[model samples]
Target: MPRRTRVLLVLFSIVTVLCAWAGLMGLGRLTNSGFLPDDAPVRDDNRRLSAHYRAGGADLVLLVRADTDVDSAAVAAQGRAVGERVARSPGVVTAVSYWSAHDPALRSRDHRAALITVDLVENEGRATRAAQDLVPGLTGRQGPVTVSATGPAWASVEGMQQSRRDLLAGELIAVPLSTLVLLFVFRSLLAALIPLLTALVSVTGTLACLYALTFVMEVSVYAANVACALGFGLAVDYGLFVVTRFREERAAGAGPDEAVTRSTRTAGRTVAVSAGIVALSLCCLFTVPLGFIRSVAVAGVLVALLSAAATVCLVPALLSAAGALLDRWDVFARLRRARATGSAGAEEGAGWRRIGRAVCRRPVLWALAATAVLLAMLLPFGHAAFAPSDARVLPAAGEAHRTQEQLRRDFAIVPDRTVTIGLPRGTDRAALDTYARAVAALPGAAEVRTADGVYRGSTHHPAPAGTAPVAAAAPAGPVLTATAASGRESAEARRFVREIRGLPAPGGSALVSGEPVRVVDTTAVLSRALPPACLLAAAVTMLVLGSFTRSVLIPLKAVAMAVLSLGACVGGMVLIFQDGHLRGLLGGFTVTGTLDGAVALFVLVVAYALSVDYELFLLSRIREEYLTTGDNTAAVIKGVQRTGRLVTAAALLVVSAMVALAASGVTLLKVIGVGLAIGVVVDATLVRGILVPALMAWAGRWNWWLPGRLRRRAATGDRHALSTDEGAEHAH
Candidate 1:
């Protein structure tokens, strides 16, 4: 081994050890569901509501079911006791119960259930801790009431815990299954083990990076899940590319050192370009305002870069150490024997050559047919709708999901469906009345409430005696709120918020906020950002491919093919999840009639990146062959034949990892897993296998055409020119 390679190996080993240590120590500190953006109106409204009502926002609710009426003395007393206990728990900010509020909204219509709401400190970690600490004591039979805990605080804590377990479960399944697949593909234990080791290093390093990020800013628990799955898959892919190339060179009679050097020059360049494409594509997520998607972007880019670096640096060193030993311990000796009897050059991939010939025989027909199939799959996306995530993301059997469902069913008149309208402080009574009336007059508006009184349309109802407090000498600012008849996720509720926002406010300025408004605003943010993000991804992809292949048409074709594959994956998600098809096959989940906004965008970006990833792999080989042969048709055939099996194997490993993630109970994770899995399969088989070769064949020599300056350089016996001349002579 070279001294430089040995030194690099030592440095990487020490860094890997440190990363493992950091990952273990910081694992427990990660947060979950940090999706809300700082500048979101809902976030600001939550803060304001918490400040004003003390326990309005960020409250954990205990649903107390009783054998008799919940309003009975015994049940009420039990509820109060539970509330008081929770209030005294660590990190408790305030607590309210049906007994304390005397509000009808707190009790079920049948009076068999009531709520005790407890608020914790504003910090997510502290609130999660408090909820975890209090849940056990408060749940189950307590005196006359049967208590069950559910609320945002408990949900956050439980979700984080669930995510951690899911990550472990997924890794347990994916790592082993991926290993078996790798072993089958490589037919050598040592070769398979090298990729798995590279993945381990990449994943550990990614987790350590995320852990360090958490200390400075909130890092979602989902980051670990994304990191592990993608890190493993990418490491395996890059390793497969480099190892396969090295082996090919070795088989062609190059010495081990020459094989390693040549493979690094070709496959290493491809890995670097592929990594750049993935990292740049993920960087588009930064345009999204939500923290969760941004966290995914961070973790994904980190993993891609790390995986590429390991493949280029560490894998080569390992290969150098292994030398010819990589071919030892062949599990499938019969297949090796069969290969040895075949023709030396052409027969190595005779099957792939047949496929290439078949595709090129009628390139236009195959291209059109594939494009039609992809478009047909995309038809379901027209019916797709998006909703902001809620407790519905959890499994139906989960306490949080059950509680949310129960709340929605029983508490039909709750204020959560209401939109809070902020007004300038100290507004006159007449202006407040006009503002309330205007808000109430909006379409879908049910009622409006203000400090002055409640109003139905233009009519103001007088407050009952002693219900309205006398005006204080120095009164705090007044805020008016309007409740819609429909639930927050309903179309009517969204329309109501939008119509209200369009109405004139009597106050100097007004801000509307609630769940409905949040959905609208978040959707608006993403919609505005999507175009720019897509453009950025395209530009980056074009630059990377152009640099790698030195051809403008290949990059354009790659971008177009990636978009088609992404459409198919997204369309599949909508058909399966949103339309409620394949529920039995994919596990039961509540069809919200809409996908989560973040999940949709997350899947889109990820699917596109994976598409580009496979595209680059196939293109790199084709470009190499094209430069050598100076014959587009021959290059297309040779490249596809050479890379077809490697790409297929790598895709299987990645799809396995993603499918393991689909086994998670969390609907969002499942969506991501299934969506990306489908994307990989489609890109690997239909897109890369068929459309790429077909299109390249259709373009003929035009596939290699370059602009004036580069064309001049190519004709002057450059490296590419020399390769072309040598290839022509070899063919003769």
Candidate 2:
């Protein structure tokens, strides 16, 4: 081994060990935070409401299922007791129940259940701790009623727990399965192990980086799962490229050191470009202004960069150490020997070569057919709908989801969806009353309540004596709460909030705030940010690909291909999750008629980057072959033959990890997992195998064309110099 390589190996080893330790130490302390952006308007409104009304909404809720009538004295007494116990619990700010409010809406329509709403102090960590402490004591049986606890605070804690379990389960399934796939591909145990080790190190290092980030800013619970899956996929991808190239070099008669050097020069360059593409694509998430999206981006970028670093610095050193031993301990030694002897020039992908030749034989026909199929797949995305995350995102069997469903089914009012319009403080009773009446008159508005009374569709009803609070004591402002006729996720509810916001304020300054408004605002933010994000991703991808390939048309074609694959993936998500197709086969989630907006955006960005990832792998090899042999057709055929199997193997490994994520009980994670898996499969099979080869064949020598100055330089032999330097830099 070279002295420089040995030194790098030692440096990387120390860093890897430190990262592993930091990951372990930080894993347990990672908190589930950053669900909402700090600067969101809805957050400010929620804060104002909490301060003024002493109601932080329902942080915890106890569902009291009565054996007999819910309104009966026994059931009422039990409900009150449960409410009082929760109110007295540490960190609880207030509690309300059917007994305290005497509100009929708290009682189930079947007269078999009632609800107790508890508002905890507005500290996430403290509130979660208090809620956990109170759960055991408050849940189960309370006199004649069976008590079950759930609400935002409890759900937050449970969501974090569930996410951790899902990550563990996904890794358990993905790691073993990925190992088997790698072993099958390489037919050597040592070769198989190297990629997994790199993945572990990269993922652990990313976790450590995320943990450090948590101290400075909130990180989402979902980031861990995303980081693990992406880290594993990217690490294995880079490793596979490097190792496969090394073996090919070795098979072509290079010594171990020379093989390593050549493989690093070629495959290492592709890995660097691929990593940069992924990092730049994820950086688009920063434009969305939501913590959850930003956290995923942060974790993704960390994993991609770290994986590339390991691939370039660590994997080569390991390969140098392994030398000729990489081919030993093969589980499929006979097949490996057959492969080595049967194929000349290390072009072992005869099957892929045949496919590429077949496509090139009728390039126009193949390209048209593939493009038509992709467009047909994209048809469903035209009807795609989106909703913000909510309790429905959890499993149906979960307590939080059950409570949410029960509330929706039994109660006339949806508290979470109820929009609160805050008028100026000291607003007169008549002005508040007029505002309430106007809000009630809006379409889809069920009822509007103010300190004066309740109003329905322009009709005012005075509150019972002493029920209406005197306006003189109003501190934060006079509030009119409007309950939507439809559920929060419904278009009617969203429209209602929008219409209400468009209405003239009685006090000349009113803030409309609630779950529906939050959803609307979040959607709006994402919608506004998406165009710029896409532009940035495209610009960065074009720049990176142009730099790597030095061809304008190739980068443009690559970007278009990425968009096509992403469109198909989005269409598939809409068809399966939103349109409710294949629900029975893919874990029967309640087809909520809409995809989570955040999840959809996340899938688009990540999947596009990954699609581009494979493109770079194939195109870089093709470009290299063309530069060397000066024949575009032979270059395309040989490039596909050389890299096709490796690309498919990497895709299989990534898709396997993604498919494992489908086992998660959370609907959002399931959608993301399934959607991403589908994307990889499509990109690997149809896009990479068929479309790319056909398109390159049809483009011919034009695929390698450069502008005037670059063309002159290439003709003068600067191209080789540039490519060599890029390969060396990326290799180390």
Candidate 3:
């Protein structure tokens, strides 16, 4: 065996060991989703709300009816069975169902519908367990009972579970698909396996690291899955370019040792540079305030680093070990014959090739046109409104929605908004009475009361048994409370809050905290975070590319294109999901409102980074052609033609991967997936494939222009590019 072959074997052995360890660890983290922090911003809020639910014993469940007219006994029995099961669950404190308790009016007139409330345990993991175990078990004899379980617990659990499944599925599909593509590209199974093996090693290792992270970090379920997707996707993507180049060298008849060195120096450099760009892009996720988005950014960086490692260390070793098998694909044979023919008709150029040529020939107009279209699409985003889909968060639509809705319709005196105003001890008693009177004077206000005040303006049963302590607390200033007849009259509520806020100072300030207020706050936070996040992503991209390409203007151009693509994607989502259109086509999900906070942050991160994928791919290839022969026009045409297919494939694969997420049961995941898929398609076809080349063609020398010092350095072989090219020849 050659010295190079021996070294390759050693390296492969190391990667194999590392990968095995990583697989075990990754599996452990995935299985222990509950152990992960509730890092989702929604989950964080849910945790706080769940505390209230637990304390109040206000859990919710829905009774799905097979018959429109259900009998009393059947309804009672079904409710009893479900309630009993729920009570036995880890987090359930209590259960109220038709059988356990009687509410004649609460049941549907025909007995087709009923409501149940199961108090949830305060533990986070317990909530997930209850959701998974409880709701699926609620069934009837006629048909599987459709139980929509919604509560803090179910929301947290279902979201996490669905995310985990989607990501695993993506990995399951991505690895095999990428391997197949790589095999076909190389035509040598051994050559194909090299990149796959490297990617697997990276993925396994990343998973293990993620598993370990669960102990310390609040890794979002979505983020964890996304990390795996990115790790696998990028590892294979980078390794393919490197390994293919390595095989090319071997097929060129270079000795094993020389090929290994050359492949590393060339393809290795490109991998390093590409990975750097990818890592930098992923790092931009940090700009988002939401925890899930931040987690994605963190995971993105990790995967990029892992990919870089696999391409440099792992791919080289595999190439060396494969030896002559690297070119077993008959690439050398085909190339020899092709050279002999030397005819344009024998060229691999196809429709995409022509597209590449056309794009390169008219760079500026294409770029402008694409940008305008994407910007136009983004127009709908201005009207985007985010309303939480409570149904989407739950395993099933539980009793909360129906009960709340029903209660609103029947009981006008009951407060629709459950407000919990926290105030400091010792407020003025007369002021509290004055505020109470003020609330009563409001047009829609039906009731206003402190703890001791009566809703009907008279005491019921002389404070009714258990409320005697209320008299003791009715002194001048404990914490006056009031409930409005309807939540929709937010203006009334706000007026009340303003009155309270403006009241003469007590020891501490007061805050009106409730579901409605919190929703508004979360939405506000998201809105504020978006602009900064976008700017951060742009700034980071410019900085990273500036360092790698050493051209400030090139990086700026990339950012501009990326922003346009992102805007287009957002606009499209708003039109499709927010405008209440196309719900039937997309798995019957009604677009209730704007994209949620987590998804919005996620979209910004992914769209911005993904937009750059093809831009870098095209520019790198174009730069290579330019370096080989200082002819700008020929480089643009040949480079675009050569790299276009790979970029297009990558975009399609990415879109397919994201689209697969739409199949997930969770609504938020589906939205993120669909939005990303659409964005990638538009960016790949309209922006990168057509517009980028057109812009480059228009820019000509300017695209490659750099400071004199940087231009000299760009001429010098950076280690990243040198290693990248070195591997290409060997793998051929």
* Candidate maximizing lDDT: 2
Candidate topping TM-score: 2
- Of candidate 2, the 10-residue stretch with the lowest lDDT total is 465-474
Q: Which of 1 and 3 is ahead in TM-score?
A: 1
Q: Which model is ahead, 2 or 3, in terms of TM-score?
A: 2
Tens-digit lDDT track of model 1 for 604-640: 8888988988888887777778666678888888888
Tens digits of per-residue lDDT, candidate 2, 108-223, equal 88879877877676655557767878887877777799988777677777777788888888899889989999999989999998898889889988999988987887777788
Candidate 2 TM-score to native: 0.93
Work out candidate 3's RMSD over C-alphas: 6.5
Per-model root-mean-square deviation over C-alphas: 3.6, 3.3, 6.5
TM-score of each: 0.91, 0.93, 0.76
Model 1: runs farther than 4 Å from truth? Answer: 1-11, 52-59, 85-94, 118-137, 334-346, 414-416, 422-441, 446-475, 478-481, 713-732
Q: Judge candidate 2 against the unseen true structure and give its global Cα lDDT, from 0 to 1.
A: 0.82
Please report the TM-score between candidate 1 and the true structure: 0.91
Residue 102 alpha-carbon offset, candidate 1, angstroms: 1.1
Candidate 2: stretches off by over 4 Å: 1-17, 69-74, 88-94, 120-137, 335-347, 464-474, 714-719, 722-732
Error of 1 at 403 (Å): 0.8
The better-scoring model by TM-score among 1 and 2 is: 2
lDDT by residue (85-141, candidate 3, tens digit) is 776776566565545544332355555655565556545445556666776556335
Is 1 or 3 the stronger prediction by lDDT?
1
CA-lDDT, candidates in order:
0.80, 0.82, 0.60
